[model samples]
Target: MTLNRRIFMIQSLLGTVSLTVGDQAHTEIPVLFEDDSQARNLGYKEDSRKVDTAKFPKYSAGQKCAECQWFKALPEGSTGTCGVFSGKRVNRNGWCKSFVHKE
Candidate 1:
C-alpha cells in the first residue's frame, strides 16, 4: 500500500476502535448523600457503612427501602420520595424503623 493510503487506513481503524469503545462507556451512579445536609436536617446521620442488622435494634426486619410506602422504582433503579421528607430520592438500600407498606 502507498504511504498515504497506509496512514488513512490506520486512522480509519483507530476511529472505528474509538467508536466501539465509546459505546461501552459506563455511567456512574451518583452517591445518594454526598452532602448530608438533608439527612442532618431530618435528625438522621448519613451512614453508608454497613452494620450488623441482627445485632442492631434500629435495623429491624421489614424496614427496608423496597418495602417502604414511598419507594418508587424508576427505569434506572429504585428511588423514591420519603413520606417523612417532602421530596428526596431515598436510597433503595436505606432502612428505618418507621417503614410502612404501600397500599
Candidate 2:
C-alpha cells in the first residue's frame, strides 16, 4: 500500500460519511407556522408574545410550544413538531389556541 493510495482511500471514506450525516441531519424541514392553515387559524406565532392577546384571550405570557402537551418533539432549536401541526414545525416560544399543559 503506497502512502498516497492510503490517504486517498481515507479521504473518500470521510467524504461519504460526512455527506450521509449531513443529509440525515436535515431530511426535510417541517412546515413553518405561517405555512400551515391549522396553525394560522389557531393564531400560531414563532414568538408567543406576538400572539394577539385581544383575539386569543387564552394565550398568556410564557406559554411556548415546547412546554405544551401537544408538542411531540422539541429538538435543540426554536422549531418543533406538534400533534396539532401535523408534520409542521412550531415555535419553541410560540403559542396557539391548541396549547395544552404538559403533564
Candidate 3:
C-alpha cells in the first residue's frame, strides 16, 4: 500500500478502537429504586423525580440517605433499595421519614 493509504488505514483502525473503548466504558447500571407500598404509603411515587422534603411532611432532617438501612456505598456512587420499594436506586442525597440506620 502507498504511504498515504497506510496512514489512512491506521488512523481509521485507531478511531474504531477508541470508539469501542468509549462505548464499553459508558455501560449504565439500572437504577435499583422502584415503586413500593412503603413509599406509596409515605406519599412517595415510583415515578417521583425527587423527594421534596418541603412538600412531604414525612421527610425530616434526621432521615437522610446515608442513614437509610438500604443505602449501599459503592466506589462509583451510593445506591440501594428502599424498605418500601422492592427494587430501585435511591439517591445518596435522598431523605425520607422511613430512613433507618443500617447496622
lDDT values, one for every candidate: 0.55, 0.78, 0.58
lDDT of 1 by residue, 15-82 (tens): 99998776443222333462466554433323323434554556654456666686664445655446
RMSD of 1: 10.1
In model 3, the clashing pairs are 32-87, 32-88, 32-89, 33-88, 33-89, 34-88
Clashing pairs in 1: none
Best TM-score goes to which candidate? Answer: 2
Judged by whole-model lDDT over C-alpha atoms, candidate 2 comes out at 0.78
- Please give, for residues 2-90, the per-residue lDDT of candidate 3 as tens digits: 66988999999999999988755423435533355555565543333366757786665445565667566444565544554444556
Q: Which wins on TM-score, candidate 1 or candidate 3?
A: 1
lDDT of 2 at 19: 89
Candidate number with greatest lDDT:
2
Decreasing TM-score order of the candidates: 2, 1, 3
**Model 2: colliding residue pairs:** none
lDDT string, candidate 2, 1-103, tens digits: 5669889999999999998887666347565756477777888888887888899999888888889988866555756777887766677777889889899
